[model samples]
Target: MTLSKKARSISALEIGLPIFAGKRFLDKDLNRCFGDLEASGTLIEEIRAQELAPLLKGTDILIDLHSTIKPSVPFVCVPKFDHPAAEIIPFFNTQHIITGDGLLTQDGKPIYADTFVNAHGGFGITVESGYENNSMLVELIRDSVISALKHLGVLQGKLECGLSRAVIEKTPYPLEECTIWDAYWNVIAGENFSWTKPWGNFDSMPAGTHFATSDSTKLVAEENSIILFPKDGANIIPGSEVCIIAKKQE
Candidate 1:
């Protein structure tokens, strides 16, 4: 029922490849290594980005599907770099759509797969499908793909593609249509940080509410916002992103 288990239920890019078998990466977190052509190093991830960036550039409509560590309401991210994924945002079943005006970076450099693609000549999307235990994650992902393809005229008819017909028959494309602005979590002052509470995705808090603490100081929300991708307290590290502030897009 957790995201990790659901993530591994599917295969790698190639059929029957149990690529997600082990840790997320062999050397580094692959998601953070993208968007820098000048990024250099002997680290396997660094080298992989050097090779993969060029290949992902200029893709017309690319979807970087992901899941969150904490259980969440599925949503989509449209990075602030003039990304072109608006046409298909409403195609999926998710109601929450985030478009960040603030640029998210790691160590003063761009990070994230969709941002890399968006910076290039393409429509890039980062779709975070959260915890859903009732239905298979793979089938839900497939259904989204099929829906998007049909909306774009790429697929035709009620082609379930071997997914459960019962699930597909009740599929609803109607969305809550929340266009939200984004802010990264603010607990970056020190290491070994922990949240004030176990905050799940989309948990709302008022302005001035302190959500996290390291040492004796607690981090406060500057605006009334909802949380997204709240990392477990155990994973806290210096300069690491803890969560995101999803605010109403005005």
Candidate 2:
């Protein structure tokens, strides 16, 4: 997500208040998002070449952290199937879900890292820390970072229990190419999707069950598998439609 000056003000305030009050570590700005399109594009490429490339060369795991406007659920998104890191994280645990495909931006653009990694060669994943400026979400990110570092052998610690096994699928789902027209919602029924049941990619579904609808148009799941991350917030618009993510049977 693009961070504005106003947003960064809140971010700085949040980081400073905790540390000024006697937190153990001081939060440093890794990189700030510049609103300038040209500058930001240059920065992204330079960072990829000078920073990320060097660190990730020959590395097996990478974790990218991002904040979202969605509620509390954390999402671990993998663009490719069968990645070592993707094969380790759980599909559902503590409100976190491991997903492969979904609309990454409000503009209906596919995530860049997926394509970048395929071309450059590395395993990368995006970890969505839910709801902007939330302390609990921030803590969840910190914990996940610590756990990931330990898993990578960068940190030594006792492993916690109930570490769920990763649910891997044979075939990866394709990301949908779509455009957003306008925002719409069902008046009688709230939100057009469900996540109450834990479904894996390629998991089965009844043929006639309504998966989602826009305007008067309805969509259904062709086969059973876990549904990937659902569109959250006011991100989905009227003409926006996401390609269904399906996993092959285990």
lDDT of 2: 0.39
| lDDT for each residue of candidate 1 in 15-117, tens digit (9 for 90 to 100) | 1114546445555566766745684667776776777776666355567777766677777787753433355666666777776633366344456667776
Local distance difference test, each candidate: 0.62, 0.39
Error of 1 at 15 (Å): 14
**Model 1: residues >4 Å from true position, as ranges?**
1-22, 80-85, 106-109, 132-135, 155-176, 184-189, 214-217
Which run of 10 residues does model 1 get worst, by summed lDDT?
8-17
Model 2 CA deviation exceeding 4 Å by range: 1-61, 81-115, 131-134, 153-207, 214-216, 224-229, 232-234, 237-250
TM-score of each: 0.75, 0.41
Q: Looking at model 2, how many pairs of residues clash?
A: 12
TM-score of predicted structure 2: 0.41
Candidate 2 residues 78-179, lDDT tens each? 555455445434321223334333323333333334323433455556676765657665655656565545444454545455534322221222222111
